[model samples]
Target: MVTDRFNSLGRPARLVALCLLVVAVAFLVLGRWDLALAIGAGALLGWVLLKPVRITWAIFAVAFMVPVTIDLGYPTNPSYTLLLVLFVLAGWGRLHRAERDGWPPRRIGAALLLPFCAVLAGVLHWHGVKPVVVGVAPLLCIGVLGWHLIEEARRDPKLILRIAEVFTWVSVAVAALAKYQTLTGTWPLFDQFAYDWTYTSVFDPTRAAGFFGHPIVYGSFAMAMALVSLTIRGRYWYVPFTANLIGLVLSGTRSAWVGTALALGIWLLLNVRKIAWRGVATGVIITVVAFAAVAVNPSTFRIGTSEPPPTWVSPTEPGTKPSPSPSTSSVDSVGVAGARMSDPVGSASASARFERIAVAWDGITRDWSTVIFGNGPESSVRYLEDVGIGDGQAQVFDNTYLTIWHNFGLVGLLSLLGLLLALFWRSRSLAGRLIIVGFAAQIFFFDVWLWLSAVGVLLLAVALGAAEDRPWPTLPFLNGLRKRRPRAPETSDASTPGFAAAA
Candidate 1:
């Protein structure tokens, strides 16, 4: 009876469900956690209330807009909460539907191993397991989420474009916030939540962090929006696309710039035939003009100086002999020994990143167990402290690959690579391709998913993956091309008497 009720629930039932969800969210935000929980429970009890497709749309749209939470410091974004609710409704819908659900892709098992290993390593290393669990939980949820979204997409191929349009609007909202900060000299989202939102302007602040915690994260978010905008066509399309590009520039993160550049280039290459030649030429001309002007007068443009700053070394002790300055050849070296690749060449931040990598690499290679299984989840902090770097509480290897390499070693690295490849391989639709490219570009800058704001990004990819026409791919060795159905045989003219007589 319950299944039958939900199967045929009409507009009035959906309206009631919508009202209940709104109240539940309002109650939660107002700190009435009990009331929110009760209302949510009541909505569920009415089995016929929730509409799966409409709820799916709300989950994404709200997730992008409402990264807010009941508390600070926790993963307070409610996208995760909405996702769990959606999954419940989806399961119920499937049980009473005409078609049976299929099993998820094989690659998920391999992907899930990363978390399992994290938990096991935590137990063995004697570190508290809670942090490890929290760190990997979102990843695990998104893993299954991709499969479910793909299933939904198969039923309605248009969902991917609709989701892309949703993302374009989300990107515009965030970009407007970033621009507003420039005008008002205050960022409401961060300031409202009492976050230490840095980045005063293009000159004073380190970078424009926007609603997201870090400028790099915001850049990634903007880059995602830009890619989605380019892929989807509709009214006022250029607004969000241009806004996201401007926001990316304000982010001032080199890695994000590189990622966005690469994704944009790839998108252009993939759709070169369809792109307008005049627009491309105009973009090229404007870019050249901008570059030439910046080159002519760096000071006028407020860009960096032509001369490099002097290298910073610790002052010699009062009575001790001073060290000789290194020659020109050695100046290029960065990192701890002052000997890594040139990034900002002689700057402090560049030195810190490479030094963290060199130090992190050294810490993990000390023994076979440490090297193979890694020191455990979130174990990088302890190692950093042990190595005598700023009390080890703050300094971290921001590089995701390096961090995973240091934490989970070769196996983890390989598993991560496999997942990335699998996701790329399975992206059949153009929109899905754009989402994957945008997300992959951002991750090189930071573990963007670590923050609440980025959950929508991952969810978008999941939704895109859901809409992909390709079947769940196996190992990357197998080609991702979907097999075509055979064409029906054509009836000959002789088979039709009217046609034959006319001839």
Candidate 2:
């Protein structure tokens, strides 16, 4: 009877079973028995809660396979990775099957570039074989997941909102835990438990870095959650808003503050017409109340230091001597140190970035082949290392556009820019267009374009797939160019006669 039941199962089910078995075995071999158990539990949970979708499964498989790092010392948690894989699979699967048609080429094409770039890097032997391999794998996985999401959204617009909800709740839980840890001096559970420096804030409470390593990452994640919560309709919108706000306040990352505010502001301005004013008013009230409470209790609002000293104030200048008091002197010394840290070109971080960018540009210009095709993926790391800067220095590129230019040259840069432009042009709703614009703003200061955070990826994916108002096929470009569609006349019931009686 058991054998017969097994035989009755369809090919897809069998395939899934086999895949799970392989994953289990792989985990066991890697000595991650707990992760194997978690995977099994997750599989069961996913099956029960989410109807299995083929494209989702495929995308999940692709995403899972991409993180094949030979070194294994890359400081990633096996359980967290498993969770990410499971969620990506379940979420993408649910989305793909919910939609009517498959993913479009433009979307797929954009996603494919990540893996293609990785492959090109490998072939070019940039940053050695390991960096290329490591870099490409994650890109490949993220790309597959992205493609799956785009395809899924085409079927059900609501699915994205649902995914956003789940993501927000999880982030809230994480943020709450981080906050608890911050207040009590207890260690947080998971990999973040070891990141003790995150809690060493004197001015502000350390940023609540739930599952992510850094407070900045956590802040960025919370920002995304806040935006999602605001955009979607839900019974408990305040929950996400409150949680994300708390998380952001605790994170103490100025960049996160800027990014989140910009993103949220743009989202609101564009979609104000569609938004529920009552909800907006309530949120605003809650925020105001919270801010007041925090203001009264200054300790609650504090996170890290106020700011690093300006990098241009020279200690050698007249009347620049350090102060006598310890606190004052410390601040003064920091200022002097910051000034001394400036490069020969009088640029602090800004100058260093400009210098490096100029060098990269020069290198690209010197070779037309490099300019058109890029030196390959991970080439910038190797190039920087060759120029006396260590591998760590390669991370100093603050500008994503500059990084793209240095690593992929003009072609890669243009391709990425074009993708962004296309996505912006394709956006239909005001909210969608604004979200894309905000994301574009972020790329100028941060490298989130490639990061694998759920919030970041979700924001980018949603922005890319959002529906735009396109001209009807039957209408000519110039047809009714200035004519406005007549608004439907408002109707009133005679039985509701207060206004009628007054008239």
Q: Against the true structure, whose TM-score is highest?
A: 1
Clashing pairs in 1: 149-466, 150-466, 200-205
- Tens digits of per-residue lDDT for model 2, 1-503: 96786678789977887799799989999999877876786676555444544433333232222222121332464323543564467455635454655446766678778567556635653456666665565555555555555555555555555555666677668666656645432333432223223222221222345555545556666666666566553668777777777676665544566667776665555445556878679868879854542233224355874533212222466544322111210122222223434443464445555666667677567676676666677666566666644332334455667666656666667766776676555543333444455556655655553344523444444533453222211122222542353433367442422211222
- Candidate 2 deviant stretches above 4 angstroms: 1-104, 114-136, 184-187, 190-205, 271-284, 292-367, 384-396, 428-434, 454-460, 463-503
lDDT of 1 at 503: 18
Reference-based TM-score, model 2: 0.61
Per-model TM-score on C-alpha atoms: 0.67, 0.61
True-vs-predicted CA distance for residue 42, candidate 1, Å: 9.6
Clash number for each model? 3, 12
lDDT of 1 by residue, 19-102 (tens): 888988899899998788767655643443245565456556545554442223333444445445444544544443425654
Candidate 2: clashing residue pairs, number: 12
